[model samples]
Target: MGMRLYAIVIYLFLYLPIGIIVLFSFNAGRHASDFHGFSVKWYGKVLSNPFAMDALTTSVTVAFITALLASVFGTMAALGLQQFKGRFRALFDAAIYIAIMIPGIVIGIATLIALVTAFGYLNPALAAAWPEWLGDAPRLKMGRVSLIAAHTMFTMALVIVIVRARLAGMDRTLIEASADLYATPMGTFWQVTLPQIFPAVLAGFLLSFTFSFDDFIIAFFVAGSETTLPIYVFSSIRRGVTPEINAIGTMVLAVSLSLLIVAQVMLRRRDRPAA
Candidate 1:
């Protein structure tokens, strides 16, 4: 059928480049395109490359911290938003969706400008206020901390949306029964509410980690001196794409796919009907 053919074409269009990268990752030749034979020397080289390992370490650290902060804060925001009434709730709902819809480039540029402006003022003021004994007051700048904050701010919206969706489907009677039993609000949350929404939160955390790890646009602007895996890959590609780069891309793809699968499983578990 024409429709089936069209769908096949679309699928190939979307994934053919990725498939090429994976297939060529084992290329024995120095060139990525000319695959003389299959070998994983490139993978070994990537693993042994100190710069690549350092960048991977930074990416993992930033993504882990970002996921934790986003999950906690976003869950709290979702809970608090449940109390909003009418227009107020609509306004916030719009804002959260808008944050998710905004382009990564816009966020990166805005974050870069905001950090630069804040540092400009805060650095001078801190210097003026510092005691003479503490040789040189530390100044704020874009780096790992800034990267984490930007990633957390962007990913928190994802967690809020996921948790809120789960909360909407939750059994209200369970919460009501807990309240009727004279349980404290915190007790009700821990016992009755958290148990239901925890899967969504975990899924959100995994998704957030994946996004932060794979991100390049936002990290490119705000990373300062801190290099992430994506940034390193980008830098490498500027020179030329080699088998080493292909191997790195393949590994990144594998990790991203694994996280996505786990997140999907968590979401599926949450959506499963009560046994």
Candidate 2:
């Protein structure tokens, strides 16, 4: 009974706000002042908004790129960390944890300065060298590119932690067996190592993608002028809550929740005893 109460309290705290958002999202009469009748008209308005669409497009592009980079790098880092067993293991692990724990705001500001500064350098260099596309295009914000890079920093840490955890529980004999079979080092990794880790990689990618997609704080920091869906929703709140924003919010929430659920389902399938 005590644990049940604790669970109920936690669930309520976590999901009550979402319940409210989902409720108000369907509220009719087109007023944030109070609840009205239920209608889907707000959803229709959201679909028609070009600005919201653009923000979503930008977010998707950034999320995909961030997820891909982080998954790849994190997997490599995980494998390398596993190979290392010494007093220095803690040091490397600590570094990864530090990156994970650092505030998003700090990461964002640092990324913005680095991006702008790099562009400042590249802009002049390209002008002197190619005197072509880079010169005419004039890369400043690089919009989605900057956002992706910044997001990857956090996502990479997430991937590393997840992949390392998966690796820790894995059977070590397969790797040794492949080595004993005289398979080349590269072959062992590609054939033996990578297959075991692929699910984790996919999980990391999806997890990173959803997290980055829903993220507003870090994105806001490094996003420059390229607005994301979260940023768009935030910007719209000041003007008053439109049903359109509610519709968009509902979609975002649904997508994130769905991806998370799917990832968990896949993990559970792998955990089942073989027939």
Most accurate candidate by lDDT = 1
What is the TM-score (0 to 1) of candidate 1?
Answer: 0.94
| True-structure RMSD for candidate 2 | 2.7
RMSD of 1: 1.7
Number of the top TM-score candidate: 1
- Give all candidates' CA lDDT scores: 0.93, 0.83
Cα error, candidate 2, residue 58 (Å): 0.7
What is residue 69's positional error in candidate 2, in angstroms? 1.5
Tens digits of lDDT, candidate 2, 1-275: 99999999999999988887788889897775588888888887777889988998988998888999999998999988876877789898787888888888888788878888888898778667764654465546557877887789889989999888777767788889999999999999898777776777888999999989999988887887789999998989878867677678889999999989877765664475322
Candidate 1: segments with Cα more than 4 A from true spot: 1-9
Off by over 4 Å in 2: 2-6, 85-92, 132-137, 267-275
For model 1, residues 1-275, the per-residue Cα lDDT tens digits are 99999999999999999999999998898876566998989899999999999999999999999999999999999999988889989898888887899999999999999999999999999999999899999989999999999999989999999999999988898899999999999999998899899989999999999999999999999999999999999999898777888888999999999999999999998668643
For model 1, give the 10-residue run with minimal summed lDDT: 266-275
Give the CA lDDT, 0 to 100, for residue 134 in model 1.
90
TM-score of each: 0.94, 0.87
